[model samples]
Target: MTIRQRLNKQSICILMLILLMMIVTACKSDSENVEQGINDLEADSEQLNPSEEEEGPFIPEGKVQSPFNGKWIPKEAANKRPIALQINNSLAAYPQSGIAQADILYETLAEGNITRLMAVFHVYDSEKIGPIRSARHYFLDMAANHDAVYMHYGGSPQAYSYIQQTKAPNLDGLSWLDGIVCWRDPERRAIPRMLEHSVYTNQKHLEDGWERRELRKELKENFSSGLEFVKEGEEIIPWGQRADYVTVPFSASYTSSFDFDAETKKYVKYQSGNYHLDEEINEPLMFTNLILQRTKIHLIPGDTEGRREVAVIGSGTGYFISSGRAVAIEWQKSNHGTATEYIEKKSGKPIQLNPGKTYIGILPQNLEVSFQKKAINQ
Candidate 1:
């Protein structure tokens, strides 16, 4: 055979080997581990329910209601300062532990078309919170709404500028003064994840973080979120608008789908083709309240990293979703330090939630968000 033919045969063999390696790399998730997680979610399918909302909205004689979820608790815990943690969202940050405990989550585009999360916790009880990521300035704006002490690792220049200008209460896990609150998981690090993907925060971090930042634990007397809840025995049935399922187009790789079960009266969350679960609680992270807060988004001038600005504050169009339906609503944020208000466009009354865990989607206005009467393939 000619030398050219022999070289051609060798090149074909190399290309075939490379293609096989690519296929294996893409399918390398430990199947046994994934199957076990799916099994656990099935077993723990009963964690969240609308029956949790059965209590009267009226504050009992001595009990205080949480401003976020409207659950009754000691008055002392009622108004605790919220801690907003920035959790990473790359595929490497899989199984974000303890996120289901957050009272509210703010999701928006970070770098690329990908998204990031700022999870606010009033009770401060999540044991494994993150491979905690950097801060986004607009996320800080939401954190400021609750007077939350912002906790993050690193941050973009824009975020740091906002922190400096507002003198916002913040705890940086990467600061020489505060990195003590963050620890690298030995096993995770051993997995040889990118160093950024191995860091996590625990209860100890919470304790020290508060001490280092000199922040208070609870709210002052008479503080309120001004959030309304649906009256007992009432449902948020939209006026003939179907909303049994919604799919958010956050990115080509990452999006979230929620299914409302009439029997349970809770939204079962699915993301990236799996039921999103709290690995710690072994339960699907369900919500009685969900909002799609759509707003104008823009790219910062001359920015190469592709971080964009999200208009979360000020008046905008949005949707309040519950009970297998959605109502068009207007969301207003009066100023930097004030809480966001969701008002019914038709009745002009404040939108009331179902008094259980809530999910808020901070989506770009231009994205093609859609819903269905039936669910996407499970």
Candidate 2:
């Protein structure tokens, strides 16, 4: 062969080999780039979004909010006024029929040493409520605050007078007295509370009563509860001292205590050394917030039963308990019609409750209220 031909062949071979090497190199580089890119993407994703455990609870969906609890309620229910029910809390009233459904519960002395409850039912549809008792005049103050339709068997002369003066919408069992709005549950295996404790109210009568009375069903204007709230699932309470247990003795025979449960972030209610359970749910009612108010409770001159008259509409001192913490608070009201605003003693801001049901307990000004973080309550 000629020398030139040999040289050309050698050059062609070298060029082909060079091209093949370049192709292989390029392929390897692409593979490495893809692997590096995948690693980078994964690292970025981990940094941006962590596991749910590291994060908090899922944000609640829906815009409709309850002015009562500040939780999401149905749009239909949001504007509706709550039902303020006067519930008996006597020993005969053990295992209250429907109080667990209350958005807010007011525990106060009605008459005697016995404490009574006025449960303002909102966002809950309880089938049967109450061996309903009579209403005390101060209860009207709370009832009017929420614009709730007051429910009771009977009322004191003061209460009846207040009801007439305010022109408040009310449902009285005394008008029907078990004939329509309420009933006597003869099968209730409670202590012989006589025919009195047997009275129970159902939803059917309430619907009927409202339609008959032609009262305002839903709110027309924007209404606020004037409460502050922290984000949900947060255990940190901005105000208040950490307390494991809070006890408020209403009287010698009747004292109620609340034990905070860290697991549920709720307070389990105990009254007279027993857990206050609901008859229907068979569960002790729990509250997210417990308010202890020491106010000027007076004796009504003509009230033969010694029905207590709590001066709830005036400025007073109270303790707001939630999330195992208690804060000193001041409660004030412009009038009986306005909600008693609970102000943080230090911040001067309206007391914000944990995001759930709340219980407000009003004691006589002289009653000793205590809170402790000891191991016995823990």
Candidate 3:
């Protein structure tokens, strides 16, 4: 072959090799770009959908939020029916047991200008619950509103008649389950007070009694307390006046008060001129919500013991105090089978309570409730 032809062939071969190298480099760049694109997509996915641990604490399965207090609890516990005990509030029964654990506490006038408490409990396993007293008819209405099992030592004639009419599931300390589920406290009996104030019950005894009675242990399907709660980390400032301290007078002789603690954002309860405490724990009773409901309460027409009848199945005005603030509210109850609805007067919306215990005072219409921006002692 000629030298020129040989040189041309060598040039062509060199050109082909150079073309192959360029193609390989371009392919390598494309492969790297594809890999980088995939990495970017993965990063975007991670940003959009964080892991469970990154969002918040992991909650175990079979847990649900409690309707009573808006706290997380086991589904089983949340589904169980609440228990309402007619706790004696006589001065002699100071520092009642297991009352601090109550999800809801109710104060109303009993006979002889004395006040009584109906403590409603859920998600609790208290060893001791009372100094249980006799039930008043109105308390049964409240208990039925919560779908709770009622417990009392004995009841007024009106209360017994109402129980029979409603067929409410109740345990009576004066009945067949006296020795089995309730007994007179030896320590209390040793005191000089009447034997009526000595009756007490505990969790274990109540549970056994419930089982024996074959009462429904679970709450009714789709049951709601008609209580709304603020979301976590949400701040709700009421438009009403500040209430650092509140005083509720159920009767001329009986008064209940609360002092707000800014640090804990809860109200420290004071009753009978002292801090109310649960004797079992010796801790002062506190609450996160306070509701003073005004209702028509009057003495039964011909009752010998001065048993009072409370009008609970009606609408009324009230005050709701929480987070060191007070707001006027309206409450309505359609019937005994329904829960009370508390609506803010300003917004005309159902008031949302802070997550914790609540104290309700069913005051008479004529009573004058008062609150101040500062503590009374301060």
Error of 2 at 332 (Å): 0.8
Kindly report which residue stretches of model 1 are placed more than 4 angstroms away from their true locations once superposed: 1-61, 177-179, 220-222, 231-240, 373-378
Per-candidate clash tally: 1, 4, 0
Candidate models: Cα lDDT each = 0.78, 0.80, 0.87
Where does candidate 3 stray beyond 4 Å?
1-62, 232-235, 373-378
Best-to-worst TM-score order = 3, 2, 1
> Which candidate do you rate higher for lDDT, 1 or 2?
2
> Which tens-of-lDDT digit does each residue in 63-85 have in candidate 3?
77678876668887878899899
Q: Per-residue CA lDDT of candidate 1, range 30-100, in tens?
A: 66678889988876765543355654455566666578776666776766687888988777677778888
For each candidate, what TM-score against the reference? 0.80, 0.81, 0.83
Query: Which candidate ranks first by lDDT, i.e. highest?
Result: 3
Residue 374 in candidate 3, Cα distance off native in Å: 8.4
> Which one is best on TM-score?
3
Please give me the total number of clashing residue pairs in predicted model 2. Answer: 4
Indicate the TM-score of model 3. 0.83
- Candidate 1 residue pairs that clash: 79-219
Error of 1 at 245 (Å): 0.8
Q: Please rank every candidate by lDDT, starting with the best.
A: 3, 2, 1
